[model samples]
Every structure is written in C-alpha cells, then in structure tokens.
Target chain A: MTDAPDRPADAETGTDLPAGPADSDAETDPRTDGGLPAMDGAVPTRDPGAFSQLATALGRPLVVGTVLVTVVFLILPVLATFAASFAHEWAGVLPTFVRDGEFLTLVNWRQALGLTQTDLGAQRGLGGFWTVFGVPIPVTIGFSMLLALGGVVINLLVGVPIAYAVTRYDFYGRGWLNTFAVLPVVPGIILGVAFLKTYSDLPSAVGLMIGYSLLKAPYMVLAVQSSFESMDLRQLEESARSLGASWPRTFLTVVVPNAKTGIVAGAIVCWTLAAAEFNFSYIVYSSGPKPFSLFLFENISNNPFLQAAAAISVYFAIVVVVTALLQAVGQRGFALGGVR
Target chain B: MSTLDEGPLVARLRTGTEALLSPTTETDRERRRIAALALPFVALAVFGAVVPLVVMFRISVAEEYLTATAGVQFDAWVTLLASILAFVPGVGSAVDADPVYGEVIWNSLWFGAVTTVASVALGIVIAHALEKYDLPGEGLLVTLISFPISLPGIVAAFMMIVWFGKTGLLTNVFVWLGGEASLFPAVTSNEVKLTGRPSGTTIAVFGLFLGYLYSMVPRATFLLRGAYAEVNTDAEAAARALGATPWQTFRYVTLPQIRPGIVGAVILTFRTALAIFGTVLVLKALSVVTFRFDQILKVGYDLPTASALAGLFFFFTVGFTFLSLRFTSAEVTG
Candidate 1:
C-alpha cells in the first residue's frame, strides 16, 4: 500500500511522521527548495491523499495475504496427505495418530507399497514385485521408473542436439524450429490416441517411451536452451575447433559438458513427470506391468482414503527427492520449463 | 556445362544432396551440421507425432477401425457434427441427436477460460510480491509453489479430496461450525450433482474448480515470474520516488511492461487447462471433453467418434496457441 512503501522508507531514513511537529518541520525544510519548488504543494504532509492512504493501508496486505494463502493452499494438502498416510484414522477434522490406544501406525504405508497383505478385496496394493539381487522392487514402480528413464534417454538424444542447434547456429526456419522444440506440439492424450491406432502392435513400453520423449522433449529443450543461452556457445565451439577438436567432438565434449547441470535437471524433471503421467498411460496401457501412475489411479479411485493418501505419498516422496536433486543441479524446482 | 544437361530443380536437388553428403565449403558444412543436429528431433516428430496423427485422422473416417481400417466413411464425422449442432440452442430441435459431445466441449472451453483467468490474476499478485518485495525464505516459497507443477492432475484431484471431501479438513471444519454437513463443498461421491445451489445440492464442481486452480496457479505464477525477473525495477523505483502509491506504480508502470507476459501466461495456462484430463477423470464432477474421450474409447469402443473429437480439440488448441503467439506481442520465455 502507499503507506507500505513509506513505512520502510521511514524506517531506513530514521524519520517518523507524528513524532513531533519540530522533527516533521526539519524533515520537510530541505525538500521545499532542494529539487522541485513547483512540487512544494505536493510534498509530504501529516495527512496524505485519501487514495494514497487507502492504497497504503490495503495493498501490501492484499498482495502478501494472497501469497501466504496461496502457499498454504498449495502446500497444506501435501503435508496433510503425507501425515495422513502415516496416521491411524482420518474420519474427523484431523487425521488421528492413535488407534485402539496405540499412537501412529505404518499399516497404510505398508499396505500402499505392497509390503503387507491386506484383506480388502479388489483394492490391492502394488500388485506384483520383482526381485533384483535379493531385493524386491514393486513391479509397477520399477517398470514406470525404467519406462520414464527410457523416455529421458531419448529426450537427451533428441532434445540436447536441437537445443544446441537453435542456440549455437543460425539457419532458415530457426525460429519455427525453436518454437516447435520448446513448445509441446501435441498433448499426451491425443498422442496416446494416435499411438493406439498407428502402432497397435507395438509393445507398450516402446510406445510409451516414444510418446514420452515427444511429449516431454520440450522441457529438455527449454532447460538446456537456458543453460546454452547463458554461455558463449559460439565462442566455446570456435575455441574447441581452433584447438584441433572436430565439430562433433566439440559438441559432445565441450558443449555438452558445459550444459551438464541443465541436462541433468531436465532429465530428472522429465523422468519424474513421465513416471507419474496418468492421462496417456491411462489411455494407452493395454497389458503388461502397470505404470506407477495407473497404480496411483487405481488406488485413488478404488481404495480407501488413507490407502490413496499413502499411494500418493509414495509419489510425493519421489518428487521431493527429485526436487532436491534438481536444486543440487542448480535449477529452481522445474522453473526452466514454461509448461510441464 | 554439366548444369545445362539437367533442369534447375534437379540440379539444385543434386547439389543440395551432394553438399549434405560431402560438403566442400564452410557454408555447406555448417548446413550439414545444422541438419545433423536437427535430424533426431525431426525424425521423432515425424514418426511419433505426424505419422500417428495422420493415422488417427484416417481412423476417424474408417469403416471399421478395430478389425481393420478397410474402407473410408463419413458416418463418424456426420454423427459428431450433428451432435455438436444438436447442442446449439437454436439448432437443437432440428438436429435430433444427443448433445453430449457439444455439452462436453462447451464445458471444457468455459472451464478452461475461467480457470486461466483466475490463475493468471493470482499469478500476477504472487509474481509481483516475489519480485518486488523482500520476502523471507524466497527460495523455499518458490520451491513449495513449484512443487505442484511437478504433480500430475490426478494427484491434484486427490489433493482436493484431501481438503474438501466428506471427511476432508475444510468440510469437517465447516460441519463443526454449526453448519449443515450437506451445505459444504464435499466431494463425497460421483452422484453429487455438479449444478445448483449448495444448500441441498453437492458442490463437487466447486471442489473440482479448486483442483484446477491447485495445478494451474503454480504454472501461471512460474510463467509470469519469468517475465517479472526481467521487469525494469528502476522505473518502478522512480515512480515510487515521484509520490506514486504502490498500486498506482503497478497500475501505471508495471502492468504495461508485463502485458506481453500476462498474455503469454494466459495462452499457455489455458492450454494447460484444456489438456487437463486426469483431474476431471478422477473428480468426475463435470463431463469435460477429455473425459468424454475416455468414455468413448473405453466404455463404448467408439474409436471414430473419439478420434473425430480429439482431432477437433487438437486443431483448436494448436491453432489457437500458434496464432495467438504469432499475432500478439506475447513474449514466451522458457
């Protein structure tokens, strides 16, 4: 608000209105003849204009309140869901941590992860598990992770080169190509429908991988493009070339190594998204191991509330880890891409 | 002399291919390099997107899509067009067809637009606060906000259920406050009517609206934040120094600078809204076009109608997005 700016300024200047008449006079005396005499009538006074006063009183709170409310709205459900996943009962105003005088339980988490057997018919936990070196991994989560990683691999191959080309070279139709690379040309569901008809005989994993790479290539392009834009790519390429490095060598070693952070961040984001991509997976998934997102969909629509919470919390945990990794790689939590 | 033996087009093509295969000049080498770099993306786009989309269009008019796309027919297109026409108020009585597709498409547009506007308006406020004000834990605030962007739409819907379901936090609070339980916006069941007053009717659609906002606000905020990061702070400071109130400074100076960004965010966010399927599917509050695709494909096995609807949706979105960006001064930064 109008007063919001003044209060900070007043604090920084060590001046206060209504403190004393003499001090107020001392504050205004220098301004009258200092810069603009014609604006003497508009100088600060004990009473500001009605509009300014109204704005000062309301604007800061309005903006700050919106921010606070938005943050709470966005974050509270996540926290609550996580907490409820570990709680005993959620049939009241708050999820209770005590059941039958025992405080807290991991039953929901255990059941959600397929770590324990449950009596609930039709609402099965992660249905199958694959044993790898004596360690059992949930088949749904494992398959989805591999599937999403495949997408990321393709994204790297396809996205990194286009990003480099757009940034480091000039060509006809460069703008259009850049737009296409960075903007998603097709939504996932549409692509899923297309895949269903075009590649009816293709394996689900391969189809999903290709679909994911096409759907999420934009994120990779945008992220790498940001990093490429930050560096003097032309200079780097030329320097490498002058040092007797071939163009391909320069691109693979010099250019790519320089954009490591962006590439890593892009891969992490794309993997996380593809793992939990429900719309396309929901439509195109015909057989074989269910994607993690479909498992989540099953849990959400069919299972009990607490069970659903636990299922979603599994993803929330993956995202949290991925976010941390993204931060470590020097991007601010998926900010590099305009759309997911 | 060799060029005289061939036509210009053929000669140009031969030279172009020769340049790409074995370039003898710097320009040709550079051209080859560009081609090499662009080849992978082009290949993927062609095989993954273009080819499949063409096949989908073919299927839309196929006589029998499931067994084999043996013959072409316009029956699916006719049904789709007639259904859409049936939903129009003036033309409804003449069409003599179900208006479900038309209703769903209308729902998608109106809902998408409403959510886009709300999200962008809030985005401006949030982005302005983050950029202009010195808030504590700005990094953490950003991380929390952008977290939802990583979540799929189904999770977003579940988050809504966590907040507004029958035993949800807010619904419980309202019930505890001497209010009738039925009056609250509780997403109890799919049978909950999407329309009418909340006193006797369930407000599941309101819960869905909030679900849409949950996903959209963060995306819109982040999109606008990119614009905010480039705002000329000096002008704002100068306006403030010249006795301009905060609101006045923003209204007069900041708004014009970020107008393009606002437009860009609106376009992108509206696209996000239209493409949102998982949330509507899980919530089952209103029958949007995306949900209709699920019903057509999964329940009725009506591939042609679904393909026709999807084609129309795809063209509208792609056309709207590209044309707006081309015609407007919208600055869409990644």
Candidate 2:
C-alpha cells in the first residue's frame, strides 16, 4: 500500500527508458534503489503459492478464451445469417454463395423484399413497395419505421420531461416515480393481451405505436436521465432563470438542447427496437400491413432458410446503421438500455 | 377550521389541487412545476398501461369471452390455481387436474433461473476481461457484443438455428466428423430416437437454452460493465502489491465490490429470461408460460384463461423485482 506512490514513477521510468537516456539514468537510479527494495520485501521469495501459480498459468487463457468464444458464439451467426441471405443454397456445412457459376446472387434478397413473386405465396415477402414521388420504399419496412418513429416521438415527449423532473427535483415519491419511469411496467406480451379487449376498436397502427412507446419508454427515460445526471440541472436551471429566461424556455432551449445527444441516441435505439418488436406485434396484429418483426417471423417460420436469412438480414441492415449512428452520438451501441 | 366539515383528507386534497392550479409561493411553484412535468407520463401510464391492465383483469374474471364482460366469474382463477396445485406430486393426484400450467410455470422459473445464473456468470468474466485486460479492438468488441442486444428474440432463435439446426454449421461439422446424423442436435430433426437416450427433447431444449443465452449474455455483460466501471482500482493495486495473486485480488477485492452489481444483473436478467416469448415462439422447444399464453390465445382462443395467466405473471414479476430491489443493495442503471 505504501509503495503505491512508486508505482506510477516506475511506469514513467519504464516508458521514458528510450526517450532520454540521460534523464532515464537519474530516474532508474532512484527506481532501482528505492522501488526495488519495497517490491522485494512485498513479493514472496519462497515458492509461488498453489493458487497463485494456477492463476498465473491459466488465468489469462481462461478469461481470454471465454471472451473469444462468447464473441464468436454471439457474432458468427449474425455474419452467417447476413451472408446466407445472399447465397443460393445452404445444403451442406457452409452456405454456397455461388449460383449458376456466379459468385453471388440477389434472388433471395429480391424475393424477400417482395420484389419478385414466388410460389411461396404473396404473404411471404414484404408485400410490395409503397412508392413515394417516383421513389419506391419497401412497404413493411417503411410502415414499421414510421410506426416506430411515432413511438420515438411519444417517448421523447414523455421521457424527457419526466427524466428532468426526477433528476432535478426532490419531491414526495420521487424515487418511486423515477424507478417507474426508467423500469418498464409490463412486458410486451402482457401489454398485448391487455390491449386485446381494452382497445379492440383502436387502429392496429395506432395501438402498436402506443404500445411501442409504452414498452420502449424506459430506454428513452434512462438515456435522457443519464444525460441529465451528468449535468448539474439545478445549476443550469438557476443560471438560465437568473438570466431572465422563463422556466419553460430554460428547459426547452438550454436543458433539452444540452441533452440532444442522449435524446438522439435514445430515439435510434427505441426506433430499431420498436421496429423489431415481435411479441406484442405478433399477438395484436390481426389485419393491415405487417410490422417488420412479423415479416421476419413469417419468413423464419414459413419461408425457406435462405429467404428467411434474407428477411432477417434486412433487420440486420437497420440495426447496423442505427448502431453506427449511436456510435456517432457518443453511446456504445445499445449499452444504455439493452433490456427488451 | 373552516373546512373541518369536509374532513381533513378532503381538505388537504383540495388545498393540494389549489396549490397545483395556482401557486403564489416559490415552494408551491416548484411543486406545480414538478406536477406539470410529471403529468404527461402519468397520463400515458394511465391510458396505456394502467387502464389496459385493469381491463385485462376484468376480462380475466369476466363471465363471458369477447363480447361485453357481463357478470363476474371465478372459474378461470379457480382452474388456474387448481392446475398449479395439481403440479405438486401428492396434491396433483388429489386435485385431478392437468398439470400443464404448473409444468409450464415450473419450466419458466427453472429455465429462467438456470439461464440467469449461466449468463450472469459469463457476464462477470467478459466484463472483467474488458475492464482489466488490454484486449485489442475493445471498442469493436463492445460494439459487436452489444449488437445482439438490438436483435429481437426471434432473430436470436434464428441465430441458434443457424448454429444448431439440422443443416446448421455445427451439426454439419459433427456429421462431417463421422458422427451419426441421428445423434446430432438439429432443429429440423425431432424424430431420430436414439437407443437408451431421450435425444429429441434434450436437443431442442439445449438449442433453446443456447438461444436464451445468446440474448441474455450481452445484457448481463453490459449490466455488470456499469458496476465494473466503479470498482476502486487503487485498492486492487494495493492488494496486488501486498503479494496477492491475480485471482486472490479479484476474489477478495473486486468480487465484494461488484457483488451488488451481480445481484442487480441477476434480477434484471432473470426478468428478461422470464418475459422471453419470441424466442420460445420461434423455437417451440419448451412450453414455458409465455408460450402457453400463445397457445391459449391463438389455438383455442381462450381469452379468460390467457388473461388470468398474464395477470398472474405481471404481478409476480412486478412484485419480485420491486421487493428484491427494495430489500437488497442492487443498483440497476439499465
């Protein structure tokens, strides 16, 4: 414990070894004379303990192996699924990317996106494109994106203010309110079951948007709360107030703008998640355009393996783009709220 | 004194409303501001969650099915409770009810528990390595690991099939290595009955377990990473300087600090595990409670029973999560 002060000096001398030979000589003299005695006294001179020896021999390998294996286990299939989406067949150990001597083909992609009709039926693909002004957008993906965007809009409206209230104020039931705001109240399946009889007359898209907002609100709240927690909200509010700005103006112009990064990142995460939400969408979806998750489910449950891969790869493409955007906004992917 | 006729509670409530509606004092103004900020969330919660859940409970006990819920019936609750009671070995014989509900609930609890422990354990290791060691491309590693967190449970099940299905990569590798195709675990082959072994159920359940882990491990890892970030490295270094081995340093110093985090991770991850429906829906390996809800709703259209089961599940999760958090020192950031 006492030698803690010498640790940084030792590291400094080690790094400074080749930079300046003359200066390093002076540094090394004290490090060797002083740090060496302390290290010698602290370190055991006898045979290494059994546990120490075992840890020294196998610790790094064990930990590194677990990380390596877990990474491979988690990522290999994502890559494989994405690759298989473009492949012609996957009869053997590996998916064969070549078809008719061509290295790769977009037949699966085209079929999966509902661009080509197949014997698999019209329900199999994304159900054709919804063209806007001469630009065609895949209907299912576009609709789901819009629905999830609706959810994001609701989340921002509902999450940001509550996050500010909980982080900035001290009031009765504040802790409980904060917990409720940041922790999901119910799972999607339950919510779907609840929605069945309660809002049976509501439009499927509207119900889904509301459900998505409620289901994914916790993420938005958590993200925004983290941003709020980092800032001294009271100070900021007071400063803005002292500058003759109204409370609403301070919150809208100062506080909300300051946490723009978190809001954007939260929106990206919530949008992607809501778009891919399956349990609620599956239960509540009776008629109308299929959400992206239901589309993936149809492909997975009924379509061919390659086409299913292609369908799932469509989502992978969305998540990859969202992840890149999140990184740009200073969050490490979905680390902020990975639940659900 | 003038409002004594209304009773103290009503008078207080009136005053509270008045203060909220029109506040002159600074304290009252702050209180009103807080209420204004909280109003939207409260409104959303009431309409979106509270109202629906209340209607669900009404449907759970409603006398009829899809039409207007006229009258009250305890039939669904009675049957559900009887089924749960029938799961007990001796009580089951006496109750004379199908143990399917009990079985599914048991499967969910055990599966959720097993997966929670496994994933949280694995998470600790992954988080330790990421925080302690200088692993190359750490940011990329985090991104890749967290990438799955965005993938829905159905996609996770698909990933499992890509690995363990009959035409899956690992299964084919084993087949190539001269193993009997019948003995291998594949999502496609459920009919291969091997001698002296129950291969089919085990294979499917194991695949589902892997699917659960695929979704769970990253969540647990990220949860613990938050805890790992706050560990005092100075104490760890001091312990190491005192001749403690790497394992000792971790076991004595690091583990104690992150134990609360581990607890929190276990709680949240277990909640995640229990709520898992899409993966089970896709795999169709084991009939857990969530999957049972699908069967009740889709196959038989048993709305009341489904509502009853869902209500029970929601209460259990909310109660368990809140009670555990209140009692323990678990800090949940996510």
Candidate 3:
C-alpha cells in the first residue's frame, strides 16, 4: 500500500515488457534450463534453434485464427445491416440480385428518407416524410442532436464541479457524493419509467432533458475524476499559486485543460448515448418532439423495407461516428473505460 | 465547589475548540470552500434519480390507483412474497395457473445467466488473446468488437431482425443452403403474439439474446482487456520458470489477479440484461421483467401492479448492484 504512489509511474513504463522475459530474469534463469529458448522479448528473432522455429510456426496460426473468428462474430451484424440498407429486394438471407448488376438500388433510401411517393393517397405526406407531428425525418434527426447536445452541456455543468471537489479536496460525505452520482445509472429502464410516473406533471421535453442529464452525468463524473485523480494536482496548483493566479482561475485554465481528454471522451459518450436512448425517450417524450430513435421505432414495424433501412442507417451513422471519436480520444478511460 | 468545577471544565473545552477551529493554511481553507461545490450535483442526483425511484417504491406499497381490470392492491407485499416463493420447482407454478409472472421471472433469470456466462467467457478468451499475443490488425479488431457498446438497444435489435428475421439475410442464407428458412426461436405463448412472437419459435427471446450479447460481449472484452493489461506478467513468468504448465500458471497466478474484472464483467452483463427494455420491446419479447412491468402499466392500465413489479425488479437489480460495487467499486451503466 505504501508503494501505491510509485505504481502508476512504474505501470506507464512497464506496459511494453512481456511477462515471460521479466520473470526469467528473477527466479528461473532461462538460459540454464535444458537449453530451451527464453521468451526474452515480444518479437522472436529468427533463432536458428529448431524449438524456437517450431514454437513460432505453431503459435502464429492459433493467434490469427482466434482474432479472425472474434472479428467475424463481432462484425457479422453490421455487415448484414449495411448490405440490407441498400438492396431493393430480399431473397431469403440475401439480396435478390446480388449476382447481377441490379443487386444495389437506392429505392429503400429514397422511400425511407421521405423522398419517394406516399402509398396512402389521402395521407400523402411524401412517403411518411411529413407526419401528424409536423416534422420531417430531417427535423427529428436535428431534434435528436439538439437533445443530445443539451444533455451533454447539462451533464458537464453538473459533473465538473463534483469531479473537481471529490478529486482535489477532503470533505464530509464525499464518498456518498460519488455514490449519488452513480445511482441514477444503475436501473436504466426502471428509472425511465419512474421518471415518467414521478414527473407526469412536468412538460415532456423539460422532463426528458432532466432525466437524460441525470443518467449521463455519472459517466462524465467518473471519467473526469479519474483524470483528475491521476494528475499531479497539488504541484500544478502550487505553481499556479506561486505565479499569483487565484484558485478559480488556476482550476479553469490549468486543471481543466489537463483533464480535457477525459472530459471530451466522457462528453462524446454521453452525447451518443443520449441521442440513441430509446426507452426514456419513448416513455417520457411520447407527447413532444420525438427523437430519431422513436421515429425509427415507429417506422420499422410497418414501413417499406427500404425506408426502415434508410432511417436506421442514418441514425447508425451518427452514433458510430461519435462513438468512434470517443474511442480515438480515450480508449483507456472513456466509454465504460477502466476506472483506475 | 460547583462553580469551580464548571469553570475549569468550560476553560478546557474553550481551548480545545480554539485549537480545532484555527485555520491550518490558506490553501486548506480554499479547498474546504471549494468542496461545497459538489453539493448541488448531489442534490440534483438525489432529486432527479433517487426521488423518482423512491416514489415508484411508494406507489408499489400505497393503494394509489384503481383500474377497471385490476383494482388497487395493498397486497403488493403478498404478491411479491408469492412471486419469490414461486421460484421453487413445482409448488409455485400451481399457485398461479396463468404462470405469467413466474415464467417471466424464470425466463429473465435464465437469459441473464446465459448471457452473462457466454459474454464473460468470450470476453476472457478474447481479452487474453489481445493482451498476450501481438495479433495483426489488433487496433481494428478491438474497435470492431467494442463498436456495439455504443449502439442503442433498439438499433441492435433492429439489426438482429435485419440479419435474422423471417426475410432476414441469415434466413435467406439458410434457404439458399437448403436448410430451414428462419434462425429464429419459436414462440410458445399466445398472450404476446401481437408482440411478434412466432408460434413455436423463441425468436423474440433469441432476438433479445442477440441484442444483449452484441453489446455485452464487447463491454466485457473492453473491461477484461484492461485487467489483462494490468496483470503483473512477472508472476506468470516466475510460475512458468518453475515448470508449471501454461494452464496452471493462468489458473494459479493470472486468474486470481483478474477476478475483480471477471466479476465486474459478469455483473454488468447480467444487470444490463435484466434492465434491458428497448431491445426486448423492439424484438417483442415480454418475458423480461422490464417489458412486463411496462406492459402492465400501458396495456393492463394497472399502475399499482406495474409499480409492484418494478419494485420487485429493483430488488433483484439492487442485489446485483451491491455485488457489482463490492467487486469493482464503481457503478456500471448499460
């Protein structure tokens, strides 16, 4: 426990070394053991020994096969959806005309986006583009983005202070504060229903924004606190104080910038999740402007195959892009990323 | 005698108070003040999240609303006790001939267990492989595997249908290969037919399973990968140097160190599967408690019953959450 202070630094430098080589140096001197090759480094040199050569030949295929199988399993659904999003017709598990030139078509895209003619003559709103809600598919997309953005802003405002205080200060009930932040995230579906029932009187949009921020802020707090805890906060603060900057100014200018990676990563995760949230949005926002998720849910059941695919593809694109950005920024401690 | 005794005691207390109240440093005072900044967030979380859940619990016990189909039951406790006892093999099934709540609970437990075991096992294997071996395209593989974590449950469920529904790509492939046309499970219950459960097919359950696995496996992998990365390879190497087999080294040296991560992944997957709603609804599976709770409110128009069901669900969820916090010392979100 006393060595905890030095561990993180050690970890930072120690990540690249394989366990085998490090162990060989300590207890069992690998060179003295039956002339067997030592697993000294990560990459094996082209050793002339038969055993070394055989080990490489045997291990290579196993690694490749495992990676290949895992990748395929993870990617199969996305590939299937991406393919179905464009195909005009389905023949069993595949498109009807993939073997020929007509395998690809834009009809589904057109119909889904409300660019095509509406099948209902009297209810003709350009292929479900215009609905009773007086909004188009594009509008819903915009609404979803706005809602997500609003949630991100609200969460950051609530999360940053808590993160700062808990990480940098010693205070009463600080432990409880951390737990409080996390409580909202535990029972997602139940909370959604609970919010609906509890705040039935509050206007739909206002209630949803509150619910979303409550749900999303914890992820931010957790991430930002981690970034703050890992930082050399006292040293930085002392330097800023010696330079005559006020504590608030130092926190705003120095502390926040240092934690920017975690903040950005947490925001991306929060925004994407808020945009894609369906249960709360479905239950709570039923009366007001429906988000893209609800719109997709409504259309998926009865809409033309092409239209459903197109709408889903658009939403999918948004979430994937934002999520990809999150991965890029902080794959270590961002999206359900490690706590410590 | 009384005055002298009181005066000395008061003087001693005053000195102690003075010593305690004196400021240590300017920065310490600043930090103490700054710590109050967390108060508002605490208040907001309490009011927004905690209060609502508490109200749900209150509604469960309170005889609040009376519906035409099902009247208000102060007997929520009775129902809860009955439901719990229903977990026994044959005794509970005889209590409720409809077998609705019992079957739903049974299905939820089974699905949660299956999903937890499968995802955790896959996570351990893949995370170990990624951490230990230098695989080609490692970056892309990690990204792809973890991609579904960000996807909405509804979208994942929609993707499942797109891939495996009646006219789905996989279904068509099965046909092309001269096999059965659908990969979906057959439904046995008629009450949820409108929810799109095919007769004799558990497709709804299967769809929900896919949605859970699609996201949970990646999440598990992400978590376990970190655990694997943090593992002290020195110990494993030491064990290996002593001529222990690879499996022995893993079981003795590696597994114990990563036990918390393994527990974290299992609990997260299980709890997420338990709380899953949008995916189950989109896929039309009503066996899970979340969907059933929602349905009781919306379709049955029985708020009290719904509240009771939610309360019971929360009971199970809270138990799992306690386990999760104990294991990982953090709250996990789906």
Give the alpha carbon lDDT tens digit for every residue of A115-164 in model 1.
76554432244547789999878888898999999999999999999999
Pairs of residues clashing in candidate 1 = A1-A56, A1-A60, A2-A56, A3-A56
Instruction: Report how far off residue A2 is in candidate 1 (Å).
Output: 3.6
TM-score of chain A of 1: 0.84
Model 1 CAPRI rating: acceptable
Q: Write the per-residue lDDT of candidate 3 for residues B1-334, one digit (tens) a residue.
A: 5655778779877754554456377754564455446666867778777798887777776765332222345676677567756766768666653456766787788888998898788788788888877777777777677667767777777767766666665555545555454333352222222224642256566656666777677777776776787789999888666544444456667987888778766776677677677777777664577778667767966666667777778777776677568757443322
List candidate 3 segments past 4 Å from native. Answer: A1-67, A96-103, A117-137, A171-176, A179-185, A327-340, B1-31, B65-73, B90-99, B179-207, B327-334
Worst 10 residues of 1 chain A by lDDT: A37-46
What is the Å distance of residue B20 in model 2 from its true position?
Answer: 0.7
lDDT score at residue B313, model 3, on the 0-100 scale:
81
**Interface RMSD, per-candidate values to 1 decimal:** 2.8, 3.8, 7.9
Candidate that beats the other on TM-score, 2 or 3, i.e. the better one: 2
Q: In model 3, how large is the Cα lDDT of residue B328? A: 72
> Which pairs clash in model 2?
none
Superposed model 1: Cα runs more than 4 Å off: A4-52, A118-127, B1-7, B179-202
| Number of backbone-clashing residue pairs for each candidate, in the order shown | 4, 0, 14
lDDT of 3 at A219: 75
Query: What's model 2's TM-score?
Result: 0.90
